[model samples]
Target: MKRFWMAVTLLLTAGVLGACSNLGFNDSSESTASSGTKTATYQTTGTVDSGMYQGVIKNGRYQTSKTRGLATSTNTQSGTYNIKSMENGLLDLAKKQFSTSKYVFQEGQLITEATAENWLGRKSKDNANGLNPASNGKLDEDTRAPIYLQTLLEQDFMTQSGSKLQLGGIAIALGMNEYDYYQKVKYGATYTTHISDAKLVSEGESMAAEIVARLRRLSGVGKNVPILVTLYKNAGSDALVGGTFFRSVLSTSGSDLGKWSTIDQQNETLPTVNNAKPLDSNVSTDFSDFSEQIENFFPTLAGVTAQAHYQDGSLAGLNISINTQFYSETEIMSFTQYVATTAQKYLPDGAKIEITIASTAGTQALITREAGAKGFYTHVFGSY
Candidate 1:
């Protein structure tokens, strides 16, 4: 089929050039072209001394050509296309197609209109930047140029090298990729695609790899690199901050024939809180001496207990509880300030320090380490 198309295009080119030449439409000349119904006026705008602007009009379209060596040639088509409209149409078509396809996204339970919209927005942003002129600044993905280029390239390849486009194959490949990305990020399931689906050569390489690579290439924002979706969560809260579903493509080695790497880069961090949790046993031993020193610094204080939280083998935060009797709120606050300043010297680097002072006067003072300061900052209100 590719060979057939190439032959047809070559013959058409030869016929067009012959007809133009016979009609005295050569270098530095102008002529009117007609295709039964559609006609266009094309004018060459270069000197006869140089082979420039060698073009012809047909079917209301103007086209130019340049030939270097016998095997080297180039062609350019001149016409106007509505990029904004084309992108919008393609995005809408893709959304509709995916909504009904096997790759439909299920939100929390089942796919609803709201879920569909969310999925579309997510996938589009993951693939493109999610630009929509129709909506208020943001609507859907702007896919006009890539799709347009793909169409033109498909035609040119068919005309030049007898290669046909695998429209169905491309669609299937992209669908599979999206399905895998969603499954892993949303459902915590992991899988891989084998490279040995088939062994066909296109342009002296594995056609399967070529197709997959191109699909990934088109699924990116710029330079047709690749798109990766990543999700993040933590043990602290049921809320997750990053279901944004976009990341960088690491390497081509992870994406080749017979091998598709797993996407497992989810990260979790302890949420920052005023109250401190239990310290790791190894880190807990260092605080005993410090607690004694804090008690000695304030002989009037009844008792003191310190809890240090560790993150990745380093101190993350510190919370000190002070027990006292008859101390006024101001006196309790002053005690917390003393502890804040004294603890900073002994606490691990980068540890957030908080001091809670409880007194028999039915008043409590909660002081936090001041930002960009070495002293107590402000009171934080919360249950002890």
Candidate 2:
């Protein structure tokens, strides 16, 4: 098809040039390109040199030679296509006879304005940025352009890092490579990717390797990546984020294709909280941490009978929290222990916490962690 366009464009160029030179055209670069003929007159100024007829811009039309060699142009029509029912099957808007198309951008080597506008899940506008422009992106696993751009968009969408775009939808990736095809779904505005392949080969030279490499780059966003996940959608994709295409790097795993050489990468990313935007949301907004507020609700003035080992009077204290629904002594003791355990995930070495239940008011139970390390972890508990 590209060759066909090239040929057609060449013929058009010949016709245009032939018409221009026949009217006793004797001037060089300074020649006027009147639309009609010698009877018409007009002029404009650019790099006008009477000696420079290098065909770079001769007869007021860009030439297909020199710095721009054999450039071709083919007009593919485009128009705002209202959502016609999909019952007729996916329409091929690239062909004029298929549907009324529109011009996207003829300024470069390729013009997919029609596809950019009306592809399955794309915005009617946005053939700019040289980005995919479509809601979904180009996914040629074998090529770096599509996958890298997809990774960029995915990162932005996950962190809501840049201007956010869209949410869960069924989308397709258009590309020209081995990771050339697949479906991606946008759920919770995060992306989950799945693959449909005849074989999942993790061998060094196989297509699976390229796919894994691309995914690893995308997953570098870590837990900051949003989790717009869905086990199933009508589009048959497991997940999506901001509509960028993502194929599970794990596709190379579970069989001869297992591990995908990403076990180390995936291991690092698995523990990051993607679905919960903890940092993006309000600090006190209760979410997946419901089990940490019991002690604050009841102020219990209780005594502890444990070994308060303070080595050489160092700054050490016990951290406590009540873990009981009734806020009883047993619960207070549990709270004390829980805080100490939770502290391990956030304290400095050798620092300690001493937990004490003060008292229980009407509906409030007070728990305290008498630790010198408390100040160091104030931000963490204060957010609680």
Candidate 3:
């Protein structure tokens, strides 16, 4: 057990340093604060992707989000996958509009943790600013109003001016629930009320507009800061895959939102379990072939699965998981090598690919190939 953890630590250190170098970022470099003082740039500890920005330090200290830890607080109501997708997906979408070359990322500092909690709760005499509709004294799903808005996430983008960083833009993602699950009485039977697509979109846009206006009124936030708001529809509590953003709006200037644009993104489990039809037949077949090759190579493997992401009917990324029973270092390395080779051969072209090989104990190896890259980076735990 100790050896396994030791291997993981070394792998993580190498991966982080390598990723920083690849992104052309000096994580150790110092930057001048707005107060005319110098401090180390605050580099984030982890990333969803190696290509993601590690974030720029503001002031002398790392400014933690005013609404930190809220994601987990609502993770029960919103599935864990949905929570992750809402945060990471927003960053991916924001990069399209806010280029990484021009802007340095920062956590949302404008919204306080308390304010976020209030807004996510049901409106009442004490909390009138709540985004969720006021609760009437009804228990039935039909009569009771559903909580449309689940959580709000804010991401700040900054532009470097000399050694100091200034707020260049902001991206806010609102996570809306597809179904409102609640217990009629405390610890009693739980009931769910389905929220239609039309209603979710309509309510999301209205909430976004209000959020924009409120943001403009904040002290540090001026009327000119470009704000991008996106609405994410969360998957059901029992869903294996997370939901995707349906609509987005960009306010380049002033408080009023511009036209909303449709985002055609989706998440699907590969191999089409339960006789479900594949969304993309070609990709599914390729994955099936890849799995078959791996299993045939090592018949003792427990199982193989993958989660495929798509944008506009095109493959965007693939995350594959391989469960193995082998623990020997040499065997793991051999399997990893074969998996990487087979992945390049069978996976669709022009999409990011990541694969993890794990045993009953823990992760044994990792392989990744960036989109458009011809080769893969393979790392087997304890191999070194």
Model 1 error, position 352 (Å) = 2.0
By lDDT: ranked, best first: 3, 1, 2
TM-score, cand. 2 vs. native: 0.18
Largest TM-score belongs to which candidate? 3
Task: For model 3, name the residue pairs that clash.
Answer: none
Candidates ranked, most accurate by TM-score first: 3, 1, 2
Candidate 2's clash total is 42
- Root-mean-square deviation (CA) per prediction: 25.3, 24.7, 9.3
**Residue 357 CA error for candidate 1 (Å)?**
2.7
Stretches > 4 Å off in candidate 3:
1-50, 58-61
lDDT of 1 by residue, 228-289 (tens): 21111111112121111111112123244433323222212122134435234444544655
Instruction: Give the TM-score comparing model 3 with the true structure, all chains together.
Output: 0.84
Q: Comparing candidate 1 with candidate 2, which one achieves the higher TM-score?
A: 1
TM, every model: 0.26, 0.18, 0.84
lDDT of 1: 0.30
* Candidate 1 lDDT for residue 382: 37
Q: Which window of 10 residues has the lowest lDDT sum in candidate 2?
A: 1-10
| Candidate 3: residue 183 lDDT (0-100) | 74
Candidate 3 per-residue C-alpha lDDT over 180-234 given as tens digits, one digit per residue, 9 for 90 to 100: 7777556667788899999999999999998999888766665788999999988
User: Candidate 3, which ten residues in sequence have the lowest lDDT sum?
Assistant: 5-14
